[model samples]
Structures are given as C-alpha cells and as structure tokens.
Target chain A: MRRNKKERQKQLKETIMENPFITDEELAEKFSVSVQTIRLDRLELSIPELRERIKNVAQQNFADQLRSLPIEEVIGEIIDIELDQQAISILDIKREHVFSRTHIARGHHLFAQANSLAVAVINDELALTAKANIRFIRQVKLGERVVAKAKVINKEDAKGRTIVKVKSYVHKELVFIGEFSMFRSNFTETGDKQ
Target chain B: MRRNKKERQKQLKETIMENPFITDEELAEKFSVSVQTIRLDRLELSIPELRERIKNVAQQNFADQLRSLPIEEVIGEIIDIELDQQAISILDIKREHVFSRTHIARGHHLFAQANSLAVAVINDELALTAKANIRFIRQVKLGERVVAKAKVINKEDAKGRTIVKVKSYVHKELVFIGEFSMFRSNFTETGDKQ
Candidate 1:
C-alpha cells in the first residue's frame, strides 16, 4: 500500500513547517527518500533554498507585516532580531534582488531591510525614517550571502527621535555602511488601526 | 567645411559638462542633429538618460573628494542638499545602481540612500550606523525615477549620536520610509583611518 505523491508532499510540508530550517539530508532521512527526492519535492512546492526559506518565513512572521501588502520592490527577509540598543540580523542576497544589468540593487532595498528590522523592535505599527547618511564601499554580486547588522546609538523620548547605525558585509568584508534616524508614530493615531 | 562625428561628440561632451541635465531635444538642437543622433551621441559617451546623467554629475561634484573611497552598498548620488536640525537632500535614483538582485538587495537600499545623505552633512569622515527602522508602504521599480528625502530627528552630544529620517517617493507617491541613528567616530585617535 503506497501513498500518493500528493499525500507524501503534504506530509513533507507539515514536517518542514514544524521546522522550516531543516537540512536536505535530514528531510530525506525522515521522508525515507533520497536527497534528490526531497529537493524535487521542495522545487514542486516552490520553497526557496534553505536559507532563503528561513529568511522569508522570518520576515513573514516578524519583520514587515506587508507580506500581503501590494507594494512592489520588496524581496528581502530578516534572519534575526534584537531590539533597542542592539539590532542585528543576517540576510542573503540573490540575483533576483538586483535590477537587470545593474551591479547592485537600488540603495533603498538595503535601507529597507535594516530599517524594517529596527522598526520591528520599536513596538509600533507606524515608524518613519527621519535621516540617514550612508556610504557604499563595494558592489555585491549576484547570489552572494551577506549580513546586515544594525544597532541603536542614541534615543530621545522628549524629541521622539532615535539614532541607528547599520552595516552590511559580504564575506566578512564591510561593503556598505549607513547611519539612520527612526521616528515611531503612535499606532492609535496612525492609519494601521487594528 | 564639415566637422567630423568625433568633433561633434567632443562639443557635446563640453556642453554636457556645463549642463549635464540638458534634455535630449535641447542637445539635438544645440548639435544641429536629430534627437536620435543626440541619443546615439549619449550612448557613445557612455552616458545614461537625461535624469541619470544629472544624478551622475551631481554625485560626482558632491562626493568628488570621496570618490576614491571604497563604499560597498550605496547606489545613487546626492543631487541637492539642505541642512538644519537633521539636514535634508534631494537624491536621484539610478537603475544601474548595485544591490538590485534576486534576493540580495533588500528594502534597506533606499534607507541607506537617505541615511548616507544625512551622514554626508556631518563634517566628519567616519560615522557609524547604530540603529535604524523603516516601513515599506510602496515599491520602487526600475527606471521609474525616484526622489530620496532625509532629515535629522535627534542628536546626542554626550554620546556622539545623531538621528535621521528618510523617505523615498516616485512622482510624489511615497515608496519607502526609514529612521536611522548615526554615531560620530573620530578616527584620528585610532591607528587606522577610513
């Protein structure tokens, strides 16, 4: 009595959902199939590579809540978080992330990822970027895995402004660096009413 | 007596040097050639569209001294500047900018763009990004043309921290927003210099 491929896939999905960051070999062992079989299953399910899936799911759950938002120019995901004084995360870069015939993606993409992570820590639904001065030191290639790390340098409650610093590195080399300011708007007054 | 194509190209370069933002039609008329001919001249000179050329020239003049500096993540140039509490500037986005990748370039690119503009206002060489937050309400597309606007929100003299805010828009429609914190570092005391 053999189960249908659809049923097997469904089971696999559930298992992966339990822990989306499983290794291919582990998935193969659990499924009683070859690594190739597990890969095919993932391909059929449209699941990205392991790191990408993990990042995407993290972004969907805790990063920007705009997964359903109909805005263009969004494709990065958050991998980790630490609020307030310490903000940091790991991000993976891909070719699809870049516009056609360009050395790197637009500057905004990098800013948004780091900014979103910082916002997630703000405990507010509406946050605004106040100011930032950044520098680009290198060009990120396609499909290269990189890390985006940020932190809070200063805060002022009376003035309602916070200062943040972020750095993006490729293979341990500091590629891009930025310092930003974040303004947190009260969710009650903002349009993101629940 | 007829000027060869090379001579005409030289003249065009000089004209663009004076007014890089000149329209294609204006350039064509000035060169006594059709728009198509002028376009060909641009391509031969390795210059982008009118808007891109404007940004290129503006960035060149703005960061001329720091052009030799190695920055990895930034993609575009600072076109105009205004300073006060946090400082602000008008930046033009270019498609050829790096960070446009499949999953490589994140939303932070825009944030970094505005953030960098803010930091440039600082009369220091090295400022670190301490923390940042951002919201993605809209998406920026390739060749769509956008403006990055940033402002300072807060600063802590004791801690040497500054806060900045940034927003990106395509034709006045908000595309991305961000907040950042920058830390002023005096590298002179350190052994290495940026």
Candidate 2:
C-alpha cells in the first residue's frame, strides 16, 4: 500500500536516520514516490545530503568524547563511543583508497581505521601507541563498508598503559584484527598535570 | 647568484625531482625569481602543480614495480623500492591529516605510511599481513615530512612468510617503527595459479 504524503514524510525521516548513506533513488523506490518528491521531502525536513549527513553525524556523536586527539583526525566515522571502554567506527572504501588496477582496498586503510579507533577510545589527555600487534585476515574491495569495533582490554594506571583490541568486519566477515598497547600521560584533578 | 632563465628552468626541474612537494613560492625564493617567473618556468618545462607532480612521481616510479598491488594504493609516495629487499617512501602531513584543534598529525597516518611501505617491499604475486608489531616513538606535527624506510629482515619460503621492518623519521628523528610478517600466495610460472 502507498503511504499518503504526510505519512510518507515521517517515514522518510526515519529511513534516513536509519541509513544516512541511502540515496534519493533508493528512497524513492522504497517509498514508491518520484525522486523529485523524495528531494522535496528531504528539503522540507531540513535534512542535508548524504555526505553532509555523514559529516554531521561524525562531528555530533564523537567529537567531544575525544580527549587525546581531535575528532577530525580519526581515520573513519565514529558512530558510538564509551570512553575507556569501547568504540565503533565505519569506513567506506572509495576509488582513492583502492588500487587503481585491481580495485582492491589497501590494507593500511583498514589498519588506520582500527588503530585510530583504539586511540580514540582512551580517556586521557594524551594517548600514544606503545605497541601494536595486528593481522589482515582478508582482502577488502572498493566500495566495501568496513565496521571496526575497539574494546579496552586492560588498563594499568601505575604504568600509564592501556591495552585495546580492535576488529574490523566487512558484511559480518572479519577482515582484520589488532591489539594495541597505548601509553597515556599522567593527569591530576583540577585539569593540572601530575 | 641567480642563474639565467634557461639555467634556472633546468635547475628547477632537478630541484623538484629531489623534493617533489616543493611549493611554487619556495621554488621562486630558492631560484631568486618571482613566483610568476617560477610558474612560467614550470609551464615551459611541462610540469604540473605541486599536487600533480607528487601524483606523477608516485605513479611513474612505482607503478610498474608492483607485482602484488597497484602503486596508487600505497599510502605515500614511493621514491625507491627493491622488491623483497628494501623500499623508501615520503609522506607529508598536511592540514587534513592533523587534529583540527591541536594541529598534531594523527598516529594512524604514520602507521599507514609504515605499514604500506612494509607491504610494498614484498616480492610476490600477493602479499598480506599476517601480523605486525608497531610502536609510535613520538607525536608528529602537521606539515612534517616523514620518510619511511622498509627493509626485509627475514623470509621463510616454506612457511610463505616474510618479515619486514619499517622505520619512519621526520628530519632524521625517529617517530615510528614497525615489524610486519607478511604472507605470500603461491604462484606458478606463466601467470598460472599454484
């Protein structure tokens, strides 16, 4: 059954919220409406385009949570983060990230996504990688969306070291795994150094 | 002492070859000429802008040497490489690579440069990372030029694994180091699968 314009607009907003990267064509097909209608509905809802939406989500969700580094420096878009606990990030491989002839995504990009997430999860003024052990399980192709999950495994306040494990998946299949030992500077209360 | 136009143009080409990312303003200062004169010299030499020159150098030097992947996939500009022996690359940390508020270069960018250099040094039809041990010795700042050198330390042909060590430096100061264990696929002659 087709939804009325009023109902469809409400559902359109929900759909975009669910998947920010969905295109106008896909939304029109799903809603059984003209592409023009979808565009008009988006304009009325004050929703930006896909790229802007991605940037906004990244900036709004995880920017302030970062203490050691700025949010813009993260290699991927962070969707969720719990300081000193866990974090999740998404990376979409584009043409520039892939080998020109083979269209295979470079392994370093996957490493970057995982490594940055591990650093971003720290709750300190400075987080640096002391050591990392990593593996690439499979080759990723262009246009693939990689979801990386990073968890804090251990923290040693006396030594000022934290251990984080990161795993990257493409369509639920693991592509890379890494364990990072991070070094953080000592900080005291009142925002002063120890 | 400033050379004449012809001599300066020839020296300009050589200078760019030595430092692919030299800016027009810097070139003008180095050659004791106006920026406009430097631009004209580049035009006569059929040289593109700084960005294009970097891209061209990356493409022209390493494109054909790659056996496992395309050169464009490398994180930095590969200036020298000897398959399974050694390789060197340069990465310039620009504004986009740094934290917006702090101007500190992201750690993952440094890791990407080192990790990709390790992968590019392997001589095989396919190279994948089995494991990597890495360390960030210090924080890198924006606009720093990082030179990463990768050397193959060991190879276990029977196990299909090669160990490579990469060290990255900014102005001769060590910033990052990594040891990578890479897996190579078995391939037969005549470009046939094993």
Tell me the tens digit of each residue's lDDT in model 2 across B72-141: 6688889899998999999999997776766777777887788778878887767767678888777788
RMSD of each candidate relative to the true structure: 10.2, 8.7
Give one digit per residue, the lDDT tens place, for model 1 in B1-194.
33589998998889888887789999887778889988898899987888887666665665643321223323455555543244344445455332333221234555556656655555455554545555655445555555777676665533456667777777888876766655555422222223
Candidate 2 residues lying further than 4 Å off, grouped into runs, are A1-42, A45-61, A187-194, B1-63, B187-194
Question: Which runs in model 1 stand beyond 4 Å of their true positions?
Answer: A1-35, A41-53, A64-76, A82-86, A91-120, A131-146, A153-156, A165-179, A187-194, B1-194
lDDT of 2: 0.82
Give one digit per residue, the lDDT tens place, for model 1 in A53-97. 876776666445332121223234455555565555555666545
- TM-score per candidate, in order? 0.42, 0.68
DockQ of each: 0.11, 0.35
lDDT by residue for model 2 (A1-194), tens = 48999999999999998999899999999999899999999999999988888778767767877887778778888989999999999999998777675677776788788888988999987776777888877778899999999999897644557899999999999888999887777533222112
| True interface contacts retained by model 2 | 0.67
